[model samples]
Target: MMISYADSALSVLPPLLAITLAIFTRKVLLSLGVGILLGALLLTDFSMIGSGEYLANTVSQLVWKDAALNSWNVYILGFLIVLGMITALITVSGSARAFADWAKLHIRNKRDAKLMTMFLGCVVFIDDYFNSLVVGSISRPITDRYHISRAKLAYILDSTAAPVCVISPVSSWGAYIIALIGGILTAHGFADAGHLSVFVQMIPMNFYAVFSLLLLLCVAAFSLDVGPMRQHELNALRGNLFDETKGQPPGATTDLPEADTGKVIGLFLPIAILVFATVYFMVSSGADSLAASELPFSVLGAFENTDVSSSLFFGSLVGFIATVGLAIQQKVEWSMLVKGMVVGARSMLPAIYILLFAWTIASVIGQLETGKYMASLATDNIPFALLPAVLFVLAGVTAFSTGTSWGTFGIMLPIAADMAMGSDSSMMLPMLAAVLSGAVFGDHCSPISDTTILSSTGASCHHIDHVVTQLPYALITAFISIVGYTVLGFTGSLMAGLISCSVLFVISIVILHFWAKK
Candidate 1:
């Protein structure tokens, strides 16, 4: 039912109540269920209050009529099903066991186990969502075999996922940035100009992305652990970090399984297809140019008309289905395959709910024009040079609170870009980069973020457990980014800012290493 204000309040009350309940209960699913029920109740209450017909309409509107139903939800669900099928096939064919066995032979040490994960994360930089799922699933067994903590695994997965994509040029994220920048430039009266090219060329100067990559590299290279991460590593080193639920079959003494070459090939096949298809669709969609080709229309004409997310959703679905079919052909049983698919899809339930809740919150906030309201509240007393940073932080806060990075970007990017119109062309790239970085920064740390939930689920750790463990690391990176952006604001040299941030980041890591040991 379309809930009245009082009924809506009653409906929403349980989720808030659940949050408190979870603190005492530590029951993740129960907490999530409470939240979900609250959402349904809110809809139901509305319907009960002289809006019976509207209730069904509201439910349909919220769950089905929304853009999420047509796009993000379907894409996520499709990927989950695919992942499940792949997992079932691997388990049935004993490929997971085989891979674990191979890892035992080569990755004898804990540090190597962690490094391998970080490296794999870098290689799968095409999509943050894909990277989180693929890297975490593939590496989980190996890491567990080495007694690595799920908390640590979650940290590695989270760190590498978005950071890698924000800097990569071939991913869907890259396309979005290009399109946004193009729009921003044209809106600023720079239409038909090469402003976007200038922005792209200045990416290496994006201190936040560059420094983030360096931070990840340093963590991998030095094995520098701090806060909860350090504790987790120490526990692993003491041979007490593996989940009791994981490891070899009950009778098997060795934790690691023997390598199966066929399993590895099978695993890579779907991944390769997904990557290739993503790139192809991205290019064909006219999001960006990989090479020069002459046509009757403009070179960028394809992207001009193509909807990037639509292409991504379709391409990913196709790759997912193809991979599932291949797994079935490999003798994965239907029942077990279905079970795996169910589990995989189940893993995403928290994310789906969070997305839906976030969407509603954002939709409500938009109706009130919250971002615009906030923007208007910023007085003329604020320095013009600091406007970009202020907007960046504002966007970050919104995303953090709402736990929806795209929604945050949708509101703040246009505003920030508009504010930067009168600024130097060279400054626009860094500013935009700052906004993107801040959005990610907030999403990474927000307990409500979908990626955070997925990371926790993938690692089989408590969602809050992952959030608490990774907070310190995310904060350190964010601090570095803030400083980096500050430098960029004054100097307008992206390269200088990046270099400075990288050097400082290394020093901070060194400090953390000593502190962690102490």
Candidate 2:
């Protein structure tokens, strides 16, 4: 029988230890492995036999859950492999170089380059994974031409992805959250126009997501680079876009050959196809899911029920075919084509390894009930006025420890709803907003987070460098969000809270910009 550690403080140890080690060592796989082993040990009460069995279950959970195939994990991994190959093919065909050369004619300055990147990041809000990877592939050449650091590119990619998705009604994150919130609202006997409106209402109140996007714009428009990001930007100006010490980062195309005759269509057509195809597949998948449940179809409803992983897989497959076709049209040799495929897939191996370990450790953390233990801290004793702030902090801690915002939401949203219903039911929306803000903040900062890892991969930045450099920016936004939540809790005025957050965000950017200049 599996043991339950939900009530024990020991539940938090493994993730804490793992995260700490990862920060200090910069060894992601090692850190996650250590955390997983420790969690297994704790779940088994330090018994060898029990630990082995517990670990086996965790591994099983990674690929199979409840005797059913875990298509999400499998399809996501497949998508990564295909994406890597596509990235490689784009380079080997000289499409990347062609794009860079073409961008140079139009994008005259660093700021424009960055603004374009941020713009793309916002426009591709269907899914965080798609946004991060596709935006990285497309904008990388332009940003690279302007000497933008891979770390900065990764930061922008990371910032725009989850924050945008959390607010976008048509996104995978929004769909999932709306469905989950519908269940929570039903359970609490709260009636409204629908879950979508409730989610839309919470958008302005999602301080972290709102402020983080604003901060991204400030960073690009005003050159408000602060903390580690400032140093990375300086290094890039010195022609060090990547830390040579870390060796080649994932998605690096240094080894790939570029054809002199490569055209811009080689780059644009493949990615364009990828984006449109992915959207098509996403809608098609959602329609099938909705039909299975005998529900009427709507675009938002389709997004809510979409199979994101499989959609990404099929979409990427189509993009890969387009990429190969373009390469052949460019008269690329058969051997080079094979080489691009091999090298592209190989580049993703490191990311895939890190993801597997991260997933396993996350599974272990779940089995240990780490999120439940964290949620257990915000008891009935917290003041009604402070519920939003407290729940925000709790949700942040849970997401940071668990390295999964969706998991954090699954654990905390219902709890927030229940607590608000028991206390000041009027505070329910703010409390729910707090959880969303905090979870995104935590997921944004966690080194083990899949989006974080993918952001690094997409920008071809070293994972540790991406994690370390983005921390200060994410923290600042998080700090502003907490203050906003505190204001909302105390004043019961969303406007007051939003004004507070907006003012603080602007002030922080101004201060940081000046500080960074020195």
The 10-residue segment of model 1 with minimum total lDDT is 248-257
Q: In candidate 2, which residue ranges exceed 4 Å CA deviation?
A: 64-68
Tens digits of per-residue lDDT, candidate 1, 8-124, equal 224234434444554456554565455544445554553444334433444455547644575545556555545544544554445667677778889878778888998998898
Q: What TM-score should be assigned to candidate 2?
A: 0.98
TM-score for each prediction?
A: 0.78, 0.98
Global lDDT scores for all candidate models: 0.62, 0.91
Task: Spell out the clash pairs found in candidate 2.
Answer: none
Encode model 2's per-residue lDDT on 143-212: one tens digit a residue.
8889999999999999999999999989999999999999999888866648988999999999999999
- Cα error of candidate 2 at position 304, Å: 1.4
Q: What TM value does model 1 have?
A: 0.78
Q: What is the lDDT of candidate 1?
A: 0.62
